[model samples]
Target: MEFFTEYGEASQYQIEEIIGRGSFGVVAAAVDTQTGERVAIKKIHDMFEHASDGTRILWEIKLLRLLRHPNIVEIKHILLPPARREFRDIYVVFELMESDLQKVMQVNENLTAGHHRYFLYQLLHALKYIHAANVFHRDLKPSNILVNSNCKLKICDFGLARASRDDPPLAIFWTDYVATRWYRAPELCGSFFFKYTPAIDIWSIGCIFAEVLTRKPLFPGTNVKHQLDLITDVLGTPSHETLSQIRNEKARRYLTGMKRKHPIPFPSMFCNADPQAVRLLERLLAFDPKDRPTAEERL
Candidate 1:
């Protein structure tokens, strides 16, 4: 493929095969010739095509450099371009993993309850460290979580992540680049609030937890409205008190006007889930962000 052939600058590594492809870039599994360590090299093509895209790439590089932890993906190296002032594609080398959580779940049906517990534990551990650093991974999903045969988990893709120290208003509209709709928190679905907190990530983890247990997306909505409907179908409608806290007038009016819904009992929804896990899921998916437990508290 073109990706394998256009790596003259990365001659230190032998590209094995293309592992993944997406809008951000192409990822290839390889082995470092000098160190003999297996790695994944991501080639981001036309990285400077858009100013915003370039800025996000810079932020991802900075965050990965600054936030070093066992549960977070480590960037081993970034191959320099031939020209300093002008470069279209950038290559980043990272620790190679067997697969991501999304693919693991698809092919492996024998994942036990213990596996789920450990996965959640590791994810919470990572979140605690990230939140402690004042950063929040806004786009969290099974695909963003890398895994190994030993079940080691690491969070990746920080392009959408932002620090909460100088918290900014989240985008109201759902976009291809933003958090995937199936995993997005309710507040993010309609721009329910002005300031978003780490709790938003908590909600995403809860959704992922459910998917880990069931091997299917908990809420596979066709659109924004359908996404909210699916969420309410399980969690029920938000209480007036919670609705009162919503800063967006239109969102509040929509929730108030919608038909009242009582929560679907967790036991019934996830028949095979452990009661203790169900309780934790409840707290993580609380309608009000304030009610959701922090990563530190959960760990």
Candidate 2:
């Protein structure tokens, strides 16, 4: 297919095959003719179809431009349609990655402790940069993390991310459902008024780290209630003090009325994991967001 650089330079990229298709758009494997570099191009359709969609597209572009880190996906260039005013497609080109962490985990059953540590370290390294920019990746999961044969990992997909202020205002509800249910933080399960924080991403990282070790989701809940139940079952029921911190009355009451449970020790849960790794996991998975360590602290 024909493509052009932002500076109006004519370039040719042969689409090899369709790589992925999601709600946002289609991604395809391609090769740049001039450089012979393998690349992945995401063609976002109807980016300006609705006001909200246009806003989201712009937000993602802005964040990607600002975020520069080794562990984060790099945007090579943006290819707009020839006619800018009537453009219907937005193509974003990125360095091609061999696969995502989810697929890697599915096939690699003999992952070592060092592999787990390295993956978590790379993830936190990326988070350190993202959070340093006052940005929160609302969606963090194995699928969103790209991995190569060399075992290098990079964080991708910032469509759900938002700028977070140092002192975030309360009741600024962007979306009740932000993250994938399995990796979602407890506060996000049913709490409508919970403010955004980088700690939310830490909760997801904890879930991912657990999955890396066990080769399964830490909390595989079928729905919102079940998700919360799975989390509390392992972490134990939230204390009265923790409940008080929840801004959603309905969620707080639901958690409070649940049968009290003592936390299952991390070592028992991750039987073969490194003791220090388990300790860090516990801190990352704290019920209270305030108790969760920052990305820099985790690193």
lDDT of predicted model 2: 0.86
Residue-wise C-alpha lDDT for candidate 2, range 1-299, written one tens digit per residue:
33233424335677788889988888889899989999998877877888777777788888999888899998998875677675776888898999999999999988888899999999999999898888889899999999998899999988888987645463375776688999998888987345767888999999999999899999999999999999998999887888878888888888889988999989999999999999999999998888999999988
Model 1 lDDT, residue 228, Cα: 86
Instruction: Give candidate 2 misplaced runs (Cα > 4 Å).
Output: 2-11, 166-171, 192-194
Full-model lDDT, candidate 1: 0.88
- In angstroms, the error of model 2 at 152 is 0.5
Query: What are the Cα lDDT values of the candidates?
Result: 0.88, 0.86
Error of 2 at 94 (Å): 0.8
Please state every model's RMSD to the true fold in angstroms.
2.4, 2.5
Who wins the lDDT comparison?
1
Candidate 2 residue pairs in backbone clash: none
RMSD of 2: 2.5
lDDT for residue 65 in candidate 2, whole number 0-100: 91
